[model samples]
Target: MNHQHDHSYKLLFSEPRVVRDLLTGFVKEEWIDRLDLESLEKVSSTFVTDDLRDREGDVIWRVRFGDDWVYVYLLIEFQSTVDPFMALRIMTYVGLLYQELVKQKKLTSNNKLPPVLPIVLYNGERRWNAALNVSSLVQSVPGGLEHYRPDLPYLLLDEGAIVASEQWSIETQNVVSAIFRLEHHRNLQDAIDLIGLLVHWLQAPEQTRLRRHFALWVRRILLPSWVPENEGAEWQPLNDLNEVHNMLSERAKQWPDRWKQEGIEAGRQEGIEAGRQEGIEAGRQEGRRETARNMLERTSMDDQTIADLAELDVEQIRQLRDELQSRP
Candidate 1:
């Protein structure tokens, strides 16, 4: 299946209501109070690197903060593996964004750059162990070079750490928190409970838009995992919180059997991917051996030259030549 998580996340936060909830509910109140959430504007994530390569998937916003304008740099870290150099990568992106702003004449007469609040929204299965700041990856240097090391750190919103709690603001903010909570659920029952709670929070009549958006997201990206066989057609017509609860409760009866099948299928996919990689490596090695043999038979190049050209070890090249000589 083609995973659409990158697009799903971008769409989720694209709503100004969702972004406002994120900043006001999850972020510190002091930072929230400074910004005018009403003026939060979605900016283009497409940016050209120094090498002129275009990069995408990250979300950004330009908002008015008090009397000044600031940028929000949101990096969506959805890959399975953790990147140890994430801090340095964010630094480069921030620098490039500032350069773009300057090129567009968005800077002040003194050439002062706008303040950026960098945030990472990571949802990988494994816990994040990478250093939080680029300075942490830098080797300690003398006073002369001390200023060269960067010390910026991005705020991390790890889904693994999120839980549904009273601390979250009510209504849409609570629903967003529940969405993150669903990611860390231990079993189908827990997941169902969280989904039910999310629907319940959206029961307010004024929250029709939020409910529609959340339900669409759940159906598009999340339902397949919960009900594997028919792609959850039964739950597609969900209209209210009560309907969500009833559907989930009914599916709970077959969860045990369906869950086992899904687990087996997941393992089978992993094995297939591993075997594909191994076959590619084996093919590459065999091709190199054939190249070494051809060079030995048809060319005047020595073993070292053949080895260098074919990317084979000198010893392997010699062995292949010996095997060829012994064959009639």
Candidate 2:
């Protein structure tokens, strides 16, 4: 019973356990399936980059499924739009995680490297199918691999309707429904519950909006309707919204998506920074004189000189300029 009006984007900001529950629900596997996931017992999540130097805690969820002896990364991304480097981002995270494991000696040479599964759960209204997204592929080509649901980091989580429906399971449905409400619902009460749900996940131990709504809905409506107030408890956790938020966020980082962002974005950027894959260039570094002379911007320089200075394909430069012009 989620309404479009009520939504909680900050849930990931608050609770880690609830987010874990959601991930556990979606994957239908123990939090430690991979050896490394269980052994490290860590979930690292953060923003894509520094935003005013304060992380938004937007890039949600990460975990390892194995014993402490070995584990890799299982990352989940919650985004409104598909970035071009989605796959590349996942690859970088998984690779870096292995490096972290090695640095900490949480995993050893004897331990097998775990596969990093990255799932991007999108909430934006537009369909994400595109030439770049691997969702459409049924097979992997040479050098390019296709990701399947069986993979730990597989996505497709936030088609929020089912998640928001309350009819869905604790892991997926509640989270999904809450997200859908952000884009669709309007009721203040509904909004409160969604917030409460997030707060609950955050493990806040106070009178959250859910409690408030339960108080009103039960006393004002459900009690009179002959239903018990306990029904809400079955779904909502009993704690302060803030506590729940922290708890949930902590737990979720145990998953991969969150851990990667923390490494890549540091602790400031919510998620936009997470979009930057290792190989992705965040635009170009413009230097006026590093070249043996320039061209176009300086015709005195030959094409060879211009190419040597910038080291850019002429076509690539043309595309970049065009792309910049198209930006709003």
Q: Candidate 1's residue-wise lDDT over 86-121, tens digit each? A: 999998888888888878877754668888888888
Per-residue lDDT for 1-328 in model 2, tens only? 2112122433332343334444544555554443232223335543232232332333434344433232323333445565655555555455555665556555534575544445555554445553333333334555545434222224455455433444533454354345445334343234444655654543344425543333332222212212123333432442344443344335323422332333334322423454654323332222211221222321222344344446656555555445544778
What lDDT score goes with residue 32 in model 2?
41
| lDDT value for model 1 | 0.70
lDDT value, candidate 2, whole model: 0.40
Measured against the true structure, the TM-scores of the candidates, in listed sequence, are: 0.67, 0.40
Mark the 10 consecutive residues where model 1 has the least summed lDDT. Answer: 164-173
Give the deviation of candidate 2 from the true structure as CA RMSD.
Answer: 22.7
lDDT of each: 0.70, 0.40
